[model samples]
Target: MPIQPGETIPSMKLTQGTPDGPRETSIDELFGGKTVVLFGVPGAFTPTCSARHLPGFVEHADALKAKGADVVACMAVNDAFVLDAWAKSQGVGDKIVMLADGAAELTKALGLELDLTARGLGVRCQRFALVAKDRKVAHIGVEAPGAFEVSRAEAVLGAL
Candidate 1:
């Protein structure tokens, strides 16, 4: 089943590229005892993801933080290097945490994995955003396929 509001995120390790190097972070380590805004995209550098999905969050990171979000992050089914590059290209590297779900482990665990093999993309994550506090999801906004409505920063911020 898909993860629902109030469900505690499963323990999983994700890769985040930092100036020091690639770091491994667990759900507990990232969201435990913190209010977090986590948004997931199908892939890094994809058209919609690069243009609207990510930029929306990037442009509103400070506003979301001011609304009580301790951390604002973006996750995609790509390697750390690609995610890092995309973050830099978007000019939001410092504002949003770019996480790489190299193996789709986190996406599958959340039941948000979408099979796009016909498009040669293989498995990808659905576009969604979650407001989490202390490792439990407080609110979830899942976008419909090919739609960009709920997961935008303004939408999630309003929920907060």
Candidate 2:
């Protein structure tokens, strides 16, 4: 089963890009003492991920923050370079934090790993959105494969 409400985010490090290069950060450091909206994508720059999923959060970031979310972040199974490039391509800037779960460790820890080897995508994180308050999950929306209803930004903001 995937991570559920009331459960704390798993303690695993994820990489993020910076001027100095890639920096590894743990879940606690990202979510602890903060109300954060973390959304995961199968891959950065992919169709739905780039076209809709990620953009939704970026568009609604201020609304989410006004609703009490401290940070709005986007996570993917790609490396820091790829994520950083995608963020730039999308003009994300400071609107959202781009997280790189390159090793799938955090996805596996959350029980949300999706096997896409059949499609030549290899292992990936499922499409999902979560509200973590002080490192604990408060709301979660996981979409079925190829679906985008529940994990959209509007739904997550409504939950908040």
Candidate 3:
């Protein structure tokens, strides 16, 4: 089932890379005692993702922070290198936390995995954003296929 508002996130270890090396970050570790804005994209560097989705957040990082987001993070079903590079290219390395769900573990756990074999894109994440406080989801915005309405920074800000 898709995760819903007021539900505690399950304890799942997701891989992310820092300046040092790749490591595991648990759901609790990420959401515990924090107000977080978590957004997922289909893939790194894809047209819609790069042109619209991720950029919206990157452009509004300060606004989001001002609205009580302790951390704004972007996740994709790609490797750490791709995510890191994407963040740097967007000039959002300092603003957004880039997380890699290389094996689609986190995507599947959230029931947001998309099978894009027809597009030759393999497994990807559905576009969505969640406002989380203290490890529980406060609001969830899931976009319809090929739609960029709900998960945009503007939408998330309204939710906040």
Candidate 4:
């Protein structure tokens, strides 16, 4: 089952591409003692993800922080290098933290893995967003296939 509200974020290491290089961080390190809004995409630089999903968060990042979010993060199954490049292309800068779940370890831990092997995309994370406070989930929005309503940044802001 997918991770639900009130469940603790599982202990899983995820890589974040930083100016200094790739840094490996655990779930607790990211979400502990913080109000985090984490949104996941199937892959970085994809059509919908690049056009709307990510840009929304980038635009509303300050609003989220104003609403009490300490961290706004974006995660994908792509590698740290690819994520870093994409972040640059999007001009993400320090507005959002880009996480690379190269092996889908964190995605699987959250039970949000989407199988796309037949399409040659391999396994990817489903489109979703969650609000986690102090390492525990307070709200979750898992988008239905081909739909983008609930997981949008606006929705998460409203949830907060």
Q: State TM-scores per candidate.
A: 0.97, 0.97, 0.94, 0.98
Stretches off by above 4 angstroms in model 2 are none
Query: Tens-digit lDDT track for model 4 on 92-151?
Result: 999999999999999999999999999999999999999999989999999999999999
As a whole number from 0 to 100, the lDDT of residue 54 in candidate 4 is 95
The clash count of every prediction, one per candidate, is: 0, 0, 0, 0
Clashing pairs in 4: none
lDDT of 3 by residue, 4-36 (tens): 999877778777756556667877888889999
lDDT of each: 0.91, 0.91, 0.88, 0.95
* Count of backbone collisions within predicted model 2: 0
Clashing pairs in 2: none
lDDT of 1: 0.91
Q: Per-residue lDDT of 14-109 in model 1, one digit per residue for the tens?
A: 999665567898888888899999999999989999999999999999999999999998999998889888888889868999889999999999
| Local lDDT at 149 for model 1 | 88
lDDT (Cα) of model 3: 0.88
RMSD of each: 0.9, 0.9, 1.3, 0.7
Error of 3 at 48 (Å): 0.8
> Which model, 1 or 3, shows the larger TM-score?
1
